[model samples]
Target: MSVLFDRIALIGIGLIGSSLAHDIRRLGLTKEIVVATRSADTLKRAEELGLGDRYTTSSAEAVKHADLIIVSVPVGASESVAKEIAGNLQPGAIVTDVGSTKASVIAQMQPHMPENVHFIPGHPLAGTEKSGPDAGFPGLFEGRWCIFTPVAETDETALKRLRGFWEALGSKVDEMDAEHHDKVLAIVSHLPHIIAYNIVGTADDLETVTESEVIKYSASGFRDFTRLAASDPTMWRDVCLHNRDAILEMLARFSEDLAYLQRAIRWGEGDKIFELFTRTRAIRRSIVQAGQDVDAPDFGRPHPLDKK
Candidate 1:
């Protein structure tokens, strides 16, 4: 694909930033990629990975001439990043972010953006339980949904350009308002991660369940939860803080449902258990049928089961 911009600045060289860099390089999405991070150590690691053409610890300096600037950091850092780079961003530059909490990021960043620049908040519903520059890999966004929660009165041309950019990286783009995006992601992404983290913590706290035994007995189900628990603590903490309301709402519902399930199990209500289990299994089947399971090993490939 042809390069979309002369220079693209990434203002956080962690998992998402480095993953964007990898895909940009792989797909030849930009003429120059400038990687920036708050930590000098991370910048150095990104340099070693050859994730970009230029590396810097200064966000302002990195965005100076860039036509596209992506702020790929924790939601809590959005304000600082916006303050640092607001003046340096090129006029008419399409600025976007890959922050998890949409409304909070927009709240933090929107005030600092100048009229000449486009500030669109985005969240890619894709990631692994990994962090840092080295954890990134190409094709991370391929077939993944990148949700752009554009504020009202957002520049349409700039939004279109950003859509093109993510498309070039093999992402399918969708748009929603910031609050709706937050609510939806709270149920789908945030709740699951919180549950995983809680479950792992619960297991760790059990006196009868030895740590060694937990480790030794972990099969596919427990192993998946472990992956979510292994996600970057700082990042997850920031997400929980920034998206507090939505997360709390989802958590409340989750607790209510869990209590019902627990009651059913304790009473040996086999029919209730069977009904809920069957419904949940049907949901998974629907996902498979819709081809929405990108994390599945057969993504973008024919499944042997399909042939059968």
Candidate 2:
């Protein structure tokens, strides 16, 4: 494919940023990639990895002369990055982000964005539990969703160009208003990570029950939650804070459902328990049908015994 932009500035060289760099280079998405990060070590590491054509610790310097800018910082740092890069942004540059919390990102970064640039808030529903520049790989966005919550004053041509960029990365792009996007992600993404972290924390506190036993018999069920629990704490912390209201709403709903399950089990309501399980199992099948996950057993985890 032809280059989508003359220059693409990546304002944070974390997993998402590095992955974009890999794909942008592999797919020929841009003529140049300027990587930036707040941490000098991270900037140095990005340079060593050859993730971009240029690297700097200054976000403002990274945006200079860029045609497209992608901010991949924590949601809480959105405004800080925006403030730093505001004045240096080139006219008509398409600026977007890969933050999970759309509403908070918009609230933080939108006001600081210059009127001449196109600021589109976005969330790429793609990533693994891994973090850092080394964890990134090509094809991470393949078969995944990239949702955009465009503002009212957004330019149509700019939005289309941004959509085309994601499409070239193998992402299935979708658009929704910021409020609705936050609500949807609260239930689908935030709550699951919250639950995972909580479950792991509870297990840690169960010393009377024996932590050693929990680790020894992890194959029972507890092992699955650890993967989600192992996600970067900083990112999750920012997600909880930035998307608090929607997350709280989802948590309340989950609490009610848990209570209903507790009452059913206490009263030996086997039929009710079976019904809920049956209904929820269908959702898993639907996700696989939609190509979001594999149909293979153990969620397609590689085992030593599997044939190559």
Candidate 3:
């Protein structure tokens, strides 16, 4: 493929950022990939891994003269990154992010973005529980969704360019309003992770269930929750804080549904339990059929160390 940009600045050296670096290099997406992160150690590691052509601890310096800038930091830190890079953005540059919470990211970064740059809020529905540069690999976003929540004043040419970029990375692109994106993610993504964390915590707190027993028997459904709960704590904490309202709304509904299940169990309503289970099982099948997930018995996941 032809080079999409002259210079691509990656303003975070974590999983998403490194993955993009790998894909960009693999696909020859840019002439130069400048990697930036606040941590000296991470920047060094990124250099050691050869994820980019240049490495720097200064986000502003990294973004200077870049044709495209991708901010892959936590949602809570979006504002700070925006402030640091605002004045350094080149004219007509395309700036985008891979934050999970769309509305919060827009609220934090949009104000600081220069009028000359195209600031499009985005969320790539792709990742594993693992993080860091080592956890990233090529083809991570293959066949996955990358949703853009473009602002009202977004430039059409810029939006299409960004869409073409993601498409080149093998992602299916979609567009929606920021508010709707947040609410949809709250139910589909955030709630599941929250439930996983809660279930894992509950298991840990079970006084009668020994830790050894839990580990030995975790090959069941509990293991799945553990994977989700094992995701980066800082990222999840920021996600919870940034998308509070939508998450709380989803949690309220989840609690009410849980109560209904509890009542069904207490009343020995087999039909009610079976009906709900049957309907919910279809959702998983649909996901597989839609090519969003695999139908493998192991959930198509590799060991943590194997991700690299």
Model 3: lowest-lDDT 10 consecutive positions:
299-308
lDDT tens readout by residue for model 2, 88-200: 99999999999999989999999999899999999999999999999899998987899999999999999999999999999999999999999999999999999999999
- lDDT of every model, 2 decimals: 0.90, 0.94, 0.94
Model 1: worst 10 consecutive residues (lDDT sum)? 294-303
In candidate 1, residue 46 scores what lDDT?
91
Give the residue spans of candidate 3 off by over 4 A.
300-308
Candidate 1 lDDT for residue 94: 86
Q: Write the per-residue lDDT of candidate 1 for residues 1-308, one digit (tens) a residue.
A: 88899999999988899899999998888899999998999898899889999989999999998999999888888999999998898889988999899999988999999998888889888889989999899999999999999988789888999999888878899999999998998998888889999999998999988998998988645776888899999889999999999999999998999899999999999999999999997888788888876646534457668899
- Rank list by TM-score: 2, 3, 1
TM-score for each of the candidates: 0.94, 0.97, 0.96
RMSD of 1: 3.6
Residue 204, candidate 1: C-alpha displacement in angstroms: 0.6
Error of 1 at 144 (Å): 0.7
Instruction: Please list the residue runs of candidate 2 whose C-alpha ends up more than 4 Å from where it truly belongs after superposition.
Output: none
Among the numbered candidates, top TM-score falls to: 2
Clashes of each: 0, 0, 0
